[model samples]
Every structure is written in C-alpha cells, then in structure tokens.
Target: MTVILERDCVIAGGGPAGMVLGYLLARSGLRVSVLEKHADFFRDFRGDTVHPSTVTVLRELGLRDRFLQLPVNRLRTLDLVVDDHRLRLVDFSTLPAPETFLVLAPQWDFLNFLGAEGAAFEGFDLRMNTDATGLIIEGDVVRGLRATGPDGDLEIRATLTVAADGRASTLRDAAGLVPEELGVPIDVLWFGLPKPTDPPPPTIAYASPRGMVITIDRGDRYQSGMVVKKGGLDALKQEGLPALRKHISDSATVLATVVEALTDWDQIKLLSVQINRLEKWHRPGFIAIGDAAHAMSPVFGVGVNYAVQDAVALSNAIAGDLAAGTAPEATLAAVQARRMGPVRKMQRVQRFAHGRLARATAGQHLAPRWAIGLLRASLPVTRRFLTRFIGLGFLPEHVDRPVR
Candidate 1:
C-alpha cells in the first residue's frame, strides 16, 4: 500500500549529521522528519572521538552539559608516537573555553540522545526502519522522497531533502552525483580491546613494518586501529596471529604491554577509508551532508565532527532564510556556497596526509633504538604538520563564528 507524508524538511539517515540537523530545524519551528533504516542506534566501532571544534558547536547549541554527562572519556591531548618518540599535539589544556579536547563516546549513544531531544521539539518526527528508496522531483527541484516504511511504500514530500547517509550513499547515487577521488591508498584494520585498568596516554603510533596504530579510549574500554596499504589485511592475516602480535608488540610499547589475544576473530573489523568530494553538494531544493557530500580518510578522524558542523551550518543558514521568506532553492544554494570552501579544504588535507603516510619509504625511517626516542624526535614536526590536517589551525571563519 502507498501512503503520503509531508514536512518542511526530510532528512534521510539518522546518523550524527541528520539527527543534529533535525534537532536544529525542529527547534526553529520547521516540520522535520528523520528517516532511519535501523530500528535502533546500536552500531559498533564508528568514529567515537568528538573533537574540540565539535564540542564548541555543541556548547553553542546548549547540548554540551548533557553530552558531557554521558558515558564518555575526556581526552586532553593527542600524543603522536613513531617508534617510541612522542609529541603532544594541540594541548586542549591550553586551549581557551571548555578545554578543546576529543570527547570519547559511542556514536550510536550520541545519536540516540540527540534523536530523543529532537522528539521533544514541537515539529520533530522520527521514522525508524524506514528506508528512502528514491527522490520525488518536479522540473529541476526535488519535491520529496519515496520511501519504504513498515506499512509499505510511501511518498514523503518536503520543501528540502537532506542526504546524510554514509560513504556508500544511495541517495547520492540516485541523484546522479559522483564523487571526485583524491586517491587515498590506506585501508584500516579496527578492533576493540578490553578497557585497560590504567590506560596509556591517548596516542597514535606509527612503526616501520606495522604501519600506523591509533589508540582511542572509550569510557570503559580502549579501541585500537591499524592502517596499512590497500589490500594489506589479507597478507597480514596470512602471517597469522603470532606475526600480528609480534608486529604490534614491536611497533607500539603501549599496545605490546596492554593488548591481549581474543579468541574471537569477529572482534576485529577491517574498513577501507577513502577520501573523496562530491562534484556538487546541492541541486535545487535537495542537499547532501556528511559522508555523502565529502568522505575523508580516517587519518585525522574529523569525519563525524565535520559532519555535525555541516548540520549546524546548514540548519542555521536555512533557518535564517526561511525567517526572511527567501526562496528555498536560493537559500540552499547560498548554504552550499558558504560550506563548499571548508569541505574542499578538509578533503585536500586528508589527501595530502594519506599520501604522505602511504608513500613513506624506508629512506624516511625516523625510528630510533627506543620507541619513545623515535616518537620524541619525529613528533614535534609531525604535530605542526598535523595541526593543519586535523582541522585545527585552519578552521573556517564561518564555523569559528556561529550564526547567532
């Protein structure tokens, strides 16, 4: 059976970006509906580190105190380690206002929290387990979306449609949008380890043979990730667990001391992180945000944070335009223009960082006898290099100043 629903905005994919956008738009008195394919938010091992820039935005939205109260770990500094040498990057302790640091929390929990808060708003509607299948277009503008809900196929008409779906976004594909590849060659092996009784410093360790090991602390556990060349996991697995253990042990002292063998291989996940930017972010009344618009490599871990920022920017821009009685198409185009520069800059940085790491040769080997020694020697320079890549030194002026 076919049903029809209408709203001011229809946001597909109830991830961080979509949920936050819904919350903001609903708060502004616009009828907003968020369609999520999942029955609930219980995914695992997503981007968990909420950076300082994101925290600043959350505070501006009045969600910081409640967000901090959740089960999350506070990360003040990012320690960069290469064969034992370490450099502390962006000391949040030194940053002004709420101490700019990465707040650690599961992505699903955060999304759930935002969704519930959005529900309290007067015009917010959440439809879980409903999948958007296609677009509803009239002339050059997108009039709404065609979706499949529990009842059956339905048509949802909205003034604007937002695609916040992840990397393999169906909406983007359906809209005939293709991403421009930046050619990132690294693939990552991710796994969660038991929360350490006494966690080591928050660090990223790079080794000669084992590639890069990124360690993030969950409130009660630790999540570790290793990046290797594309199609590297098969070769690593062929080397077996003993070889893997030895490789990690040799590369990072912290991991060597803390990591234990888990009987289940299912505990480990492998992801291919790609860096790409869409040719265009909007068409008529429809727009794309988050991974759908620009998917960045995991090197800097700013993907989710940037997505949330996009949501904030889009919501504020559109809300302002609506209040002024501007045309929806004109408003969306303006928002895209405002956001395109920052998104492009971030993609460029990701491409550069991924290239450097992927193309590193033995000639560039900076490892010293002591792992800490190598880190100390390389980290200062690396910290400076990373400041730009991590969306710190070059934050967009519009993002730095909220539209209040």
Candidate 2:
C-alpha cells in the first residue's frame, strides 16, 4: 500500500544537514518531513567533533544549556607528534571564551539530542527506518520523493526536495547530480584502544617511521585511527592483523599494550576518504546539501560542522519561502552560491594535507627540516590563525532571527 503525504519541504537523510534544516524550518512554522534510513542514531565511529561554530549555532537556537548536558570530552588543543618532536598545531583556547574547546561525544548522542529537540515543534516530522529510494520528478522538476519503510511504499509531495543522503546519496543519483571527485590519496583504519589511567597529553596525532595514527579520547577508551594509502586495505589484510597492530603500536608507542584489543580483523573499520563537490547543487524543485553536495576528507574533522553550517545557511536563506508553502527555486541557487566558497576553500586545505600525508606515507618527510623550525618559530601566530580557521570556519553562519 502506498502512503501518500504532503509537506512544504521534504528532506531525504536525517543527518546533521537534514535534521538542522528540518528543525529550523519547523521551528519557523513550516511543515517539514525528514526521512532516516536507520531505525535509530546508534551508529559508531562517525564524525563526532562538534566545533565552536556549531556550538554557537546551538546557542542561537536556545539549546546551549541542554547541549552541555550531554556527556562530552573537551579538547582545547591539538598536539602532533612528528618523529621525536612534539608540535602544538591547533589551540582552540585562543578563540572566544566558554566555547573555546572542541566537544568530543558519540555522534548518536548529538543526533538524538537534535532529534528530541526538533520533536517539540508541531510542524516537524522525523520518519525513522524510512529509506528514500528515488525522486518523484515531473517534467524536469522534482515533486518530492519515493521511499520505503516497515509499512510499505510511500510517496511524498512537497514544494521542495532536499538530498542530504550523504556522499553515496541515492536521491543525488536519482536527480542525476554527480559530485566532481576531488582526489584523495589516503584512507583511515579506525579501532579502539584502552585509555591510559594517568592520561597523557591531549595529543591528537602521531607520525613516526611506521605510520600515522590519530587518537581521540572518548573517556573510557581512545577511538584510534591509522592512516594508510587509498585502496590499501587489501594490502593491509595481506600483511595480517599483527602487522597492522604493529604499525599502530609503532606509530604511537604509548598505545602498544592496548593495541592487543584489536586481535580480530573485524575490530578495525575502514573509512574510505573522498573529497568531492558538485558543479551544481540544485534542480528546479530540488536541492542537495552536506555530503550530497561535497564529500569532505577527514583532515581537520570539519565535515560534521560544515554540514551543520550548510543547514543554517539554507534555513536562513529560504525559511520564508518554505513557510509560505512555495518552492524556493531562485533561493536554491543562492544557497549553493553562498556555501560553495567555504566548501572550496576547505577542500583545498584538505587536498594540501592529503598531499603531505601521501608523501609521508611514501617515506618522505611530512615537512622540510627548515620548515619545521619555521613552524616552531611562528607557533603563536600559526595557532591563532588555525584557531579561527578551524573553529569558526571561513564564514560562520548564524541564525538570522528567533525561529520559534
């Protein structure tokens, strides 16, 4: 049986972009529906770094106090271990007070918090376990979406359709909107390690002769990741689990004992990194946001924050049209135009980082010897610039007015 529904806006994928946009639109009194393929937001090892810009957005939405209630680990500074030298790359403390640190929490907790908060609005409807299968297009213009859930087939008619279904978005494919692949040369193998009792410095990355391992403190355990060449997982499997563990141990000697927990291959999850963006992000009655528009590399952990920013920008740009039950045809281009600059700038940074990592993985020094000295000499100036760049981003989006 087909269950038909209508709304001012229909969003496919209840990710950061979709949820935030839906929440803002509904809070503004616009009827909005968000579809989530999963039954719940319990997925692990997703992007969990909530930057200051996102915190500011939460504050603007009047969710500051509630957001602080969630279990979170604060990272004020990011340390890097390059061979025998320790470098302080980023210092968030230099940013505005109170929100000067990065919050590390489980992605699900953050999503659930947003979901619960969004539910209070009467116009918000989040349909879980609903998978968007295709677009409902009419004469080159999208009408809504076709989806499947526990009940049966579903058809949604809306003034506007948004594809936030991630990098591998079905709706994006359905709309024939392909993202231009911005080449990335490295992937990451994520695993868990026992946290030290004494607690070491908040060192986020370690680069040794063996390889690079990124460590994120999760209170009880460390969510660790080992960087490798792109499409290199097969080669890693050939080297065996012990070799992989050895590489991780050699990269960060402090985690040598705890690396034993990864005795089975199943424990390590591979993150195939991709950096891409669409030449265009919208059709007549449809649009795409977040990873659907651009897939970010896990360089500075800015993907989630950027997605949230996109949502905020979209909400600020077209909430009036959506509230009036009109398709935001003209405003769709404006949204893309407003966001493309930041996306392009960040992607350039990611590409540069990838180049450095690729060279490092091939046994080349991550940076020149003299360059390291220069970085050390300019540490103070560098941290300040990086703080604003990473924390607030190129152009931080703010809530225009009280949505409620």
Best by TM-score: 2
lDDT (C-alpha) at residue 167 in model 1: 82
Local distance difference test, each candidate: 0.74, 0.89
lDDT of 1 by residue, 223-280 (tens): 7776677888888789876776666556665666556654455767888888887878
lDDT of 2 by residue, 1-404 (tens): 89999998999998899999999999889889999999998988899999999998988899977888899888889888887688888888888876888889788888889899999999999999999999998999899999999899999999899999999999999999988997889999888888765667788888755688898888778989988999999998999998988888887888887888888988889999999999999998899999999999988899999999999998888888876767667899999999999999999999999988886567667888898889889989987998899899998999988435
Candidate 2 displacement at residue 140 in angstroms: 2.1
Instruction: Flag regions of model 2 displaced more than 4 Å.
Output: 402-404
Estimate candidate 2's RMSD in Å.
1.3
Q: For model 2, what is the alpha-carbon lDDT of residue 37?
A: 99
Minimal lDDT window, size 10, model 2:
321-330
